[model samples]
Target chain A: MKAIVVERGENTPSLIETPVPEPADGEALVRTLRVGIDGTDFEVLNGNHGGFPAGDDHQIIGHEAVGVVEDPNGTGLENGQLVVPTVRRPPEGSNEYFERGEPDMAPPGTYLERGIDGAHGFMSEYFTSPEEYLVTIPDEFAETGILVEPMSNTVKALEHAFASRSMFDWSPETALVLGNGPLGLLTLAMLDQTVERSYCLGRRDRPDPTIDIIDELGATYVDSRETPVSEIADVHEPVDFVYEATGYAKHAFETVEALAPNGVGVLLGIPEDWTFDIDGGRLHREIVLENKVILGSVNSHLRHFESAKESLARVPDWFTDDIITDVFSPINAEQALSSGNNRIKTVIEFDTR
Target chain B: MKAIVVERGENTPSLIETPVPEPADGEALVRTLRVGIDGTDFEVLNGNHGGFPAGDDHQIIGHEAVGVVEDPNGTGLENGQLVVPTVRRPPEGSNEYFERGEPDMAPPGTYLERGIDGAHGFMSEYFTSPEEYLVTIPDEFAETGILVEPMSNTVKALEHAFASRSMFDWSPETALVLGNGPLGLLTLAMLDQTVERSYCLGRRDRPDPTIDIIDELGATYVDSRETPVSEIADVHEPVDFVYEATGYAKHAFETVEALAPNGVGVLLGIPEDWTFDIDGGRLHREIVLENKVILGSVNSHLRHFESAKESLARVPDWFTDDIITDVFSPINAEQALSSGNNRIKTVIEFDTR
Candidate 1:
């Protein structure tokens, strides 16, 4: 099978022939259909993430993918069914993976190119994963099933936002999302049901159509270049909920400042450094005086993925194929990564036929 | 009337004779009883607080205080009534102290000594304030009314905690208090009704009776000097609610790190510097995986002060007068500030009679 392999760290991925995986017990062999490219994929290719090793070695590159089952190993998964697989495969029986005595591991070497010893990815003709990691896609999601992974992440963040208030009786009336990237835009979409007023903050000329989707979703847009966030917050009557997705430390501080007295700030972005300087005094004052909340969110859970799959079934109507500026065959993976167009999302289409 | 006055910036406060203030309409002349020393007072004394003008001399020390009304100008304030006044006193309909429409800005001039243009403070024989600021004490509370101010602050912190979750149905099963100061200890006492299990983190051998009271209140003590916080958290199963009252940034970060997934970390302590470092990745991961909340709190509302008065009415039974380590006449204000004993709370007992 032809696959995009990262031969060395900080090097462009190359097209190479690799052995196609077979279905093991409780696993399904999936023929690749569409694989999405994300920032994490770029990082993995550069050997910059904790999940991957420091030096670049041969690794397949893709986690956000959708494929049709070619063969099933008695896992009740039907052949020809489309599915999305889990990204992280923790060691089995470890307390870190499962809390309720469930098989929650993503299956060994299943994260496509990004796990312990990069496994062959769906950015090729075929890949195999455990039944537990695969969520069947609805027939209506055929056009946009590849977005399940990223959409599931947005779902995870929203779930965190909702869960933080699980013991409380209220929902956020207004939410401010501090970025207009793909994830941030998807966050805007996910929050449409929960937040009455949503604000998306971004640069002035980023041509990602998510901005249009944000406006279509009825969220206000704040161009960070033209207007200060403080002034925007003033007009918005102070945000009750803020989603920090800019991945910038300064935006994290500003999100806290932009919150209402008892507001909740959800930190979703991963800043480069472990250390971040925030206004501790102001945050302390807010906590004591107004009861403000600052929270953080990371990856998606299985439940989030399930809900995201259900949510993604409706994405084609909200966002069409036009949003995907370009699609490269697995052979042209380097070109897909190098093309710096203002595309909302890029996907690699494998010629399984 | 004898009072300690700051004549100019960076000048030591000197005892001097000043004319007794007469009660104007809607005002009360309170014969000073006791003043509690705090870091804020220390900042004010050193001319470091931005709230006061540095060059403008003739300022008075003390904000946390209790006294007896010698004269009442209407407003139904009774003479000889023991009371604690709210520190902020802004004129109605004035934006000088508060923003015109914002409730948070409605009250201004939190500095009792610096509020009315170098006004004399309750750290004197006599002090005058508006009747609206005075909170009446029960007849049984005269001897220990001095604690009403600090206790009220605890009430505010608790109120902020409760109000921040008012939108949600959250009732914390476990709570952690990250300080052993008077306010931190008082917060532990106040949390008795809300939290099931409480933990207080502080230094070992810090002789404050609040330790005993905290134990009495059913809270476990974790000596930061002896036990690493992570080990403590491993034993305690992660805190559901964390109150950071240590006024240390590092403590705040550690407290947040020790919180359970989906737990609330409330910032109540204000460090001197506004800057603090936080682990953004950990925070983001916690928020995403567990849906945790980080909250901030500050001074209380009028309702919180009223609750403090009610709580103080019962303090004699729970907290002994021994918490008041030393009592000084207004003339010895400098001596009270210099004493480095584990003074839980020091009160300046004015020779009001």
Candidate 2:
């Protein structure tokens, strides 16, 4: 099996021949179809993110993947079906969270996230996944099934954000998403169901195709470099929900300021340690006086994956088309792995035959 | 009418004779019985909390009071009925939040807070309030009804903390209350109903009455000055919910690290502007990876006040008795308002005549 692998602390991942995996009982042998590359994969290659398997000298670098079960191995999983495996698995002697189907909220250092952390990834021609970890997608979404991984995160974030406001009769009319990447755009797409007005913020100075996609989704795109998020509220109204995926530490603080009264900020960014000055006292008072909620959510559960599958199944064709800006063949796998900013999403293709 | 009035930018409050208030149409004349003095009142006197009312040189120094209706003025409130008037009222030409019965979540600078920010307070022998602003309490809690104001804030915080965790079956077993002040103690009293192993952290060194109350309620009291909260988890298990009432900004930051997976830190503290060095990057990662929630809750709504009245109704007599340490007449109002660190809660009393 040809796999894109990166040695520990290596910046570049190279194609290598690894032994093909076998399906054990209750596991399925899945042939990789497509793998999406995002900022997290880049972090793992650069030794920036946590959860590198302790004993493995090389880490397979991809978490958002789509594939087909070649062999069910008595798991009841059907062959010729597209599936996206969940990233995080329960830790040693699984705690109450995982026992209850909530590995997404498992205690830190307890779960092993495939590709980005402790487990081997699905960025190979063949990988085996437990029957419970794989969620099937409809045949209609085969081309875009890889998106289910990232989309599920947005699904879980929205679930918790709405849950935070359940104390009162909260109906948010507006939302702000702080980033124009694949995850941010997906968040904007999900917010359409909950809010009337949604704004997407990015660092670009001019019009981009991603901006057009944002507009096509009935959301306004504001260039953070020219028009700050604070000014966006001035031009419009204070955002009731802010989905932050910028991976910049400062935007987390700025998201706090961007919230309306009783607003919720769902943070999904993982940034480098950078000290920024903030008026701790005023922030405290604002949180207390305004009843603000900031939730830090990572990973997703099986339910979220199922929700993401439904979202993709019913989504407008244009959204799925515009999101995956570039796709590369196995020969051009390196290009897909090292995607530039010009692309909204870059995926590497694999052949089943 | 004799009132405790603190002139703007002054620390000393004087007992001054002011004109007794009269009930206007759709209003009720309430005969003030007793007003509880918390740290917020002291902040008002020291010019560190909020401002004096417009067109007035002084701010009345109380928001937590238990009183009786003298005249309903055709508003349907029965005379001699025990009541606690809310401190915050909606702004002129009320907004959506106020109209929806959530004035507590009103945007900053939009609502006027009685005693604390804009409107006059309840620290007078006679006061007038809108009929809708008053919540009735049963006769059994008359002596402890003054605790309702602070308890309402905790009620709202708990409501939100649970709301944030509503996405899954997250029933917390352990809790941590970061302060032994009146507000922190009240939070412990509330957490008693939800969790099993509740812990209270305070700066006190030796055996105190508050600790005794915490023990009596089946909660552990940690002397923060001796054993830091970070170590509390090391000695025991990591906490699931932390109610922060310590007016120190650093505790809010530390609270994030002390939480378990899906843990929520409900911040009720209003600290001064002191910038502390924190690893923002690491903190962001902790939030994302652990699925932690931090909610900044300030005020409460009528529902919360009613819920607080219910909590107080079912509370043990010893818990209520030990909380209110001292009660003073109008002549000793200064002593009541200027309670030292040793006291839990102090109140200034007034006669209905």
Best candidate, lDDT-wise? 2
- Give the alpha carbon lDDT tens digit for every residue of A52-107 in model 1: 33344577778888888889878889989988887765443445334432222222
lDDT scores in order: 0.67, 0.85
- Each model's fnat? 0.50, 0.82
Worst 10 residues of 1 chain B by lDDT: B99-108
| C-alpha lDDT of residue B220 in model 1 | 90
Q: Which candidate number has the best DockQ?
A: 2
Best-performing candidate as measured by TM-score: 2
Q: What is the interface RMSD of each candidate, in Å?
A: 6.4, 1.5
Total backbone clashes of candidate 2, pairs 3 or more residues apart or in separate chains: 1
TM-scores of all models? 0.66, 0.92
TM-score, candidate number 2: 0.92
